[model samples]
Target: MALKNVIGIDHAVVMVKDLDKAAENYKRLGFTVSPRGTHSAHMGSGNYTIMFDPDYMELLGVLQPTEHNAPARAYLEKNGEGIERIAFTAVDSAEGAEEIRARGYPPVGPTDFERPVTMPDGTVSAAKFRTFQWPTAEAPGGVRIFACQHKTRETVWIPELMKHANGAKRLKQVLMVAPAPATEAAHLAKMIDRETRNEADGAVVVPSGGDRADFVFLTKDQLGKRYPGVSLAGLPERGGAGLVIVADVVAAEKALGAAGVKSAGGVVVPPADGNGTMLAFVKG
Candidate 1:
C-alpha cells in the first residue's frame, strides 16, 4: 500500500557529549534554545531544545547511566557528536509502528515517555509522547529513524520559544550520506510507507509529513554540492549528515557574525560549533 505524505519531522536530534556547551554553540549560531531538561529516570537523558513553529531541534546528551541513557551515551561516544536521529511527527505511534512492521522494518518499541516542561512564564506541565524507534545499529550506513506522537502539545510549543535571532522558521530537509544511495533509499522508502524517488544525481528524495520536510539520501560528493562549505572529514559512512534549515541567510549571517560564529558560505555553520553536524541555512 502506498502511504500518503504522512511522515513529517517532529525534530532533529544532535547527540553531543555536553548539552550545555552544545546549546550555547547553537545560540551563537542565532537560535533561541530552551531551558535544559532531563527525562524521567527510566529515560535517563537530557536535552536543550530550539523550538520552531511545529518543529524543533533537540540537543540530546546522556544523563545518569540507567538503561535509557547508557545506549545513547554509547552512541555518542562512538559517533563523537553529530546529528543523531530525525524523529518524525506521527498522529499515533502504535498505528505508525504497525505500518513500519508491515512494511518489513524492525520496530524497536511503541514506548511511552514524558518529560516535565516549564513554560516561559514558570508554569509547569508534562510533555508526553509515544515513540517508535528504528535503531541505528540496523541502518549502519544510514541515518536513525523514529516516529513521535505528541500527547501534550501545548506544554512543548509556545510563542516565547519560537522566535530566534536568525529568523529561522522551519526545518526544510535532512541530508543523509550512503554508499549505495538507491539501495538505501528503497529500504527507507518502505520503512516510512512513502514513495522514494531516484534522483538524477544518484540520490533519493523521500517526502515526509505532507511534504513539509524531505528526507534526502545522497553520496558525500552529492551532498557537498548542496553544502559546499561543510567538510566531510569525519562524517559517518551511513549516518545523519546535514540539516537544511529555512531562514533569511543574509540576516542570519549578520547575527552569527555579531556573535563571532563564522560560517563557511555565510549559510553553512562549520563543524566545530555545529557539534559535528553541518548546519545549512536556506532561503524559505
Candidate 2:
C-alpha cells in the first residue's frame, strides 16, 4: 500500500571501456573479485564481472564493436568510461516492470539469469538475478530498479568483502545527477507511488524506506562542478544511471589515496578520453 518497501542498495554498475582493467582497479581497492562473464549472448553487451558486498558492484565493458544496439556503444563513445547503471532490488520484478509499463511508459522486460560467483572462501556459487528497467527521458539519470533473487541467500559476499575496520557497514545512499530533478522526482513518485523530497540545491532524495537503498538526484551543474570535466550525455534515462556511492568522505578520501586512485577534490572521474564514470564519497 505504501509502495513496496525498498529492500536495500542491491548493486551499482560501472561502465568501463576495458573490463579487465577496471576489475583490477577495484580489486586494488579491496573488493573481492568474481569470475568474468560475457553478457553478449544475452544482453548484446560485452564482458562484465560482479564485485561482491552484501550489496554489489558491476564492471561493464564493451567487448565487440557493433552498430546493431548502439546505446551501449554510444554511451561508451560519449562518456568515455564510467558508471553506467545502478540496479535496485525490487519487491517483484515482473509486477514492478508491468506496473511501470502500464503507466504509459516505454516497455521493459522481466529478465532473469543464473551466473557463477566466486566467494571469498574460495567456493563457487551460482547466483540468480531478476532484473527490470524503467524508461524515462532521463535515461541514465532515470530511476531504474532491479529486483534480484539469489538462489542461495545463506552466503552474501558483500558484508564480508566490503567490511572495513572504520565501520563502513553497507551502502546507505546513491547520489545521481540529472538535468531535471523535479520532473524526474514527480515521474518516479507516480511510477513507484512514493513521496520524494526536493532539496534546496534542486536535488531529490528518495528514501530507501528504512533499510533499503536511498537515491539522490543532483543537477548537471552540481555533478559537473564535482567532477570538473566529465560528460553526462550517455547515462541511461530513468534507470540506475549516474551514481555517487555514500561513505565517510574523509575516510573514503584516504582510502582512495591508499589505493592510488586519484580523486579530483574527492571525486573520481573516468578517463578523460573514456566514458564519464563519476563517484564521490560524501559524508552521510
Candidate 3:
C-alpha cells in the first residue's frame, strides 16, 4: 500500500544555474511563470513556479552556498541544469514522514519553510510548506524525490498564474532515462508503494495517484528513439530527461513558433531549447 498521507505528484524541481533566465525562457515557451520567490535564509535558494491546476514545475537556483543547499549546488555544478527532484503531494507531512520511516526508508525532514508570494492584486503573502524526503542516496534512477505539504495553497496557486498561452493543462509524464528501465521503475514503485506497468517499447510506468503525472523510465536508447533528431547532450545518463505535458498541441506549436523556438516535428522541444530539459506537448 502507498504510504499514508502521501498522495500524487505536486511539482517538479528543475535545478538551474540562473533562476531568472530559466523563468524567462519558460515564459518565452508560453508558460505563465510565477514571480521569483526566495526561500529561507538558511536554504540559500530561490525559485519561480510554473503553475498548473494540481501540479506545477519549479525552476530553482542557489543564491549562495549553504549547508542545506549543498546538494542543489553540487547538482548544478555536475549536471548543469535540468529536472533534479520531484515532489509528491503530502496530506500531512509529519504523518507522511512517520509512514515513510515505517516503510524502511528513513525520512529526512518534516521541515518547514516559507516564501513571499506577490499576488495578482499587489498583495504579498507568505506561502508556507512542510517537506520531507527519502535518503539522499536512495534516489531512484538518480532523481531525488520528496513529499510536500502546502500550508498555504491559495497564495501559491493564484488563478492568473495557472493560465498559460500554450494551453498547458497538467503534467502527463516525467521521463527518466536509465540503463535498466524496469529495475529503476520497480525501485521507484516500491519507494512510493506503487505498482509498475510495462510498456511495449520496454519502458516502465509508475503511475501516481489520480490524474497526476506518471513516472516513465526508459533506456537512453529508448529516449533517443522516442524523440528522434532532438539533442540530449546535457541530460544526465541516469536521471530526469524531460516532461510530457497534456496540452493542446496546436496551441503549443503556435506559441513556440511565435517565439521562434523550433520543436522537433512540432511536438518535442529539444533540450537545447528547453534550458537543458526536453519538453513534449501532446493532446489530452
Candidate 4:
C-alpha cells in the first residue's frame, strides 16, 4: 500500500558548489531559473528553483554549517556536486511521517521551514514547507528520498517561473545507475509500497503516483547502450545518472547549441555539460 498522502515526485535536489554559476548554467540550458531564496536560519542553505508543472528541480548550496544541514554539507564534500536527493509530494508531512514509521522506515522530520519569494511586483512573500526524510540507509542506489508538503504552493509555483526557454515542461523520469537494477527498483517499490515493471532495455521502472515522474534504474552499461555514443565520463558509479524532461526537442537543442553546450545527438546531455547532472530531452 502506497503511503496515502504521498502523491508523486515533487522535485530533484541538485547539489552545487557555486549556486550562482549553477543557476547560470541551467539558464543557458534553457531553463527559467528563479531568483535566489534563502532557507530558514536553522537550515542554513540557499536555493534556486527551476519550476515545471507541479514538479520542479532545485539547485541547493550550503550557506553555512548548521546541525540541520550537516549531511548535505558532507554530501557535497564527498560527491563533488550532483543530484543528492529526490522529494515526493505529500499531502501532510506529519501524517506522512507516521505512515513512513508504520512502513518500517524511520523518518527524519516533519520540520517546517520557509523561504522568502519576491513577486514580480517587487513585493516579498514567503513560501512555507513541511518535510520528512527517510533514513540515509534506506536511500536506494545512494540517492536520498524525502517527502515535502507545500504549505504555500501559490508563492512557490508562480506562473511566470513555469515557462522555460527550451520549451521544457514537466519532469518525465529520473535515471539511476545501480549495480543491481532489479534489486534497487524492488527496494524502492517496497519503500513506497508500489510495484515495479521491467523495460525492454533491461531497466526497471518504479512508477510514481498521479502524473508525476517515475524512477528508472539500470546499470551503467545499459545506460550507455540506451544512449549510444553519449559520453558517460562523469556519471556516478551507483547513483542518480540524469533526468528526462518532457520538452520540445528542437527548442531544447537550439537553446543548448546557442549556448555552446553540445547535446549528444540533440537529446542526451552528458554530465560534464549538465553541471554534473545529465539531461535528456524528449517530446511531450
- For residues 156-213, what per-residue lDDT tens digits would candidate 1 score against the true structure? 7877888888878888888888887777777777766678877787789877757467
Per-model TM-score versus the true fold: 0.90, 0.72, 0.96, 0.96
- Candidate closer to the true structure by TM-score (higher is better), 2 or 3: 3
For residues 72-170, could you state the per-residue lDDT of candidate 4 as single tens digits? 888788777788999999999999999989988888999999999998788999999999999977878788999999999998899999999898899
Better of 1 and 2 by lDDT: 1
Instruction: Name the candidate, 2 or 4, with the larger TM-score value.
Output: 4
Query: Which of candidates 1 and 4 is the stronger one according to lDDT?
Result: 4
lDDT of 3 by residue, 64-120 (tens): 889999988888778888889999999999999999899899999999999999998
lDDT minimum window of 10 residues, candidate 2: 267-276
Q: Which stretches of candidate 4 lie over 4 Å from their true place?
A: 258-266
| lDDT (C-alpha, whole model) for all candidates | 0.77, 0.55, 0.89, 0.89
Query: Considering summed lDDT, which 10 consecutive residues are worst modelled in model 1?
Result: 258-267
Cα lDDT, model 3, residue 140: 92
What TM-score does candidate 4 get on C-alpha atoms?
0.96
lDDT of candidate model 4 versus the reference: 0.89
